[model samples]
Target chain A: MMKDEFLKKLRSHLVKIPEKEKQEILSDYVEHFQHGFHKGRTEEEMVRTLGDPRKIARELIADYHLERAQENQSFVSLFRATFTFLGLGFFNLVFMLGPLIIVLSVIFSMYVTSLILLITPLFAIEALLMESSLLEFLLRLLTSLIGAGVGLLLGMGTVRFSRTFFGWFIRYLKSNLNIIKGVNKHA
Target chain B: MNVQFKKGVLTLCVLVLTLKKDRYGYELVDHISEKFLIAEGTIYPILRRLTKDGYFTTYLSESKEGPPRKYYQLTEAGKLYAEELIGEWETFNKGVDQLIKEGLDHDEG
Candidate 1:
């Protein structure tokens, strides 16, 4: 086979593989044919020895599918982890952390900027005079306590998010190793 | 052997061997021919097939004597596929062995 003829036949055989992979496969064989030519084999002799391209193409296609399947699996796992992390972050901010931070900052501002110094004595006198007002102060204290609780929940949730992402990554690595083992056994 | 059968099995065998390490094209032909009486040309198709399938990936390394030699190595998927084929081969060989033994016994009787 002429060098061009050999490449043409090989290209036809490569139709089953994805276009990018087909190019890669062709280039390797092209290199092989060139090496053979340099070693004193004529292009015709090299092509003849390489055998039927169609049969070669079929087998190559099978291998390509297997590889693609493995890659697709990993990509799915990665996507799942990414979505999970994003969901958790959104939930934490919207439902848990955001409210807690707002409440805590409110209480801190009230504690630091209270202008009720002389009025504090009057409020203490009123505490003795009116039980209903004292009950109102207790209710406000309870709301601040709930704010602290929400802050704690957000902190714990952030830790859990990190752990889940790491766990997913580890699973991806293990599955990849198994795929490599399978390929090795066939080889 | 049927051409299709030979080609399929030869491609698998070449992929499996290349998994352990890289081998130049001619070296692969010589190694496989030592075990199976095949035309030197047959190995190239198998190599091309394996590379196309993604069972093996190839690169060129400089050679001392001539042009750069193309060396093939097994990719991860190729390794896994090789293992599966090896397992299937073992089961096939066991079944064939039993049948062969039965045939021999009948012939002797």
Candidate 2:
């Protein structure tokens, strides 16, 4: 294939990356082609040795998303990074899917528990209107207040914990992707 | 021959290549591919990543034959990184060699 066709295919396959980065990535190939041409190599030879443009784009896209995930540590970004890295090959599915489900389930359960604790005070409001004795009412309110306070603390801790956990998770995914990419002979 | 194992080594090779002097993208690819038989395109991403990771710094310089090319130079951190990887490679190499010798002796016995 011609250099232009090869690069155009690569550029089309790249998604979710900034235009500036897209240009920068393409320029590397442009420079490579120029160097090869100067060395008396044909464009076809260059393209063949470079392997598939689609495979190359997969690597770049995975790297870009992984870097973004590392930078922001947001659930959305980390999810995107993980999904993109998983796209590299099937081995990732075996390695990442089980851990991913367990991690998300653990986080989800923590959030639900915190929410349940936080709403205990609302339940105490119903208890207050049920004509309970003043002492009983006061005790119920005091316990509910304590529950809400603990909930608030737990909520904050979960947020902090999830952010740090996501950071480490992204790093693991990055190294995992690196290992898979190495095993990818076509890449 | 094991691509999975070679992947980490590829990073080491790139780091070691730039240790003595700065080299351009194509020049580095050419040198390593001559030895490793890798997909020529993959090396570019590795170069970008190593540079991003602060192991290398890049600059654009003109060439006599064509447009200017980007050159990668090792940082102090890069040198230290190369040293660490080299040390690991030596230990790993010795371990593998000893295992091979033991396996061969066992088969003969």
Candidate 3:
């Protein structure tokens, strides 16, 4: 196999990578061929030594997505990365999906709880305004103020937790990826 | 050895070799493959990962025979990482050696 054919096969397999990075990756293979030829080796010899282009492209694409997921910290990129790993057969869908669902629920519940707490004060105020007795209005106003204060505190706590969780979650996913890199094909 | 085991050892070889001097993709592939058989194409992904992690920095330098080659140098961060990995590898290697020796003796006995 010559340089062009080898690189074409690799490029086809690695369609998911960004253009710049994809080119950068291909250039490495091209340089590898040039260097091999300079060393008095044939293109076929170099190609054989390098193994299958499809497998090489798969490893690189999985890794590229993993980095994108870690850097962006967005759901789309992270999910894309996970899906790529799933294709590589390194990560099980149950393992990845289970934790993802669990974490999402925790975060979703936190936000919902904060929202409910915040609105409780408004509900109290409306009820107080309709109260015929001034004493009843006072009690409701006091209780409502307490609810609002607690709600504010809870909102701030959730924000802090989310930030910390974001940092921890990225770190967790990255460690998972690093381990995957050493995964044997048969395993 | 399993491919994962080979890859871990290859990663160590790459880091240890680069610590001595910078190396290009093909050069490192040849140097490491001389000691351990591997699919030479796989090294590139590891190189890309270490570079992305900021442990190694890459630059292109002209070769006398052809197009310029991408060379990887160990950064300050990479040096630290290499040291830690080597340390862990040493301890692990020693333990493996001990276990294998003991197992062999047991088999002989």
Worst 10 residues of 1 chain A by lDDT: A85-94
Tell me the tens digit of each residue's lDDT in model 2 across A7-75.
Answer: 999999988889999999999999999899988999889999998899888878877877787777666
Model 2 interface root-mean-square deviation: 5.8
lDDT (Cα, tens digit) per residue for candidate 1, span B18-96 = 7768888877876786787775655764566556556788787887877777788888988897887667566666766
Model 2, residue pairs in steric clash: none
Residue A153, model 1, lDDT: 56
Docking class of predicted structure 2: acceptable
Clashes of each: 21, 0, 0
Model 2 residue A48 lDDT score: 92
For candidate 1, what is the TM-score? 0.46
Each model's lDDT comes to: 0.58, 0.80, 0.76
Model 1 RMSD, rounded to 1 decimal: 15.6
Worst 10 residues of 2 chain A by lDDT: A178-187
Give the Å shift of residue B89 in candidate 3.
1.0
Q: Is candidate 1 or candidate 2 better by DockQ?
A: 2
Better of 1 and 2 by TM-score: 2
lDDT of 3 by residue, A15-103 (tens): 77888999888888888887888789888878888988988888787677667766665666666766765665654444767888787
Stretches off by above 4 angstroms in model 2 are A90-93, A126-134, A177-187, B1-3, B103-109
Error of 2 at A172 (Å): 2.2
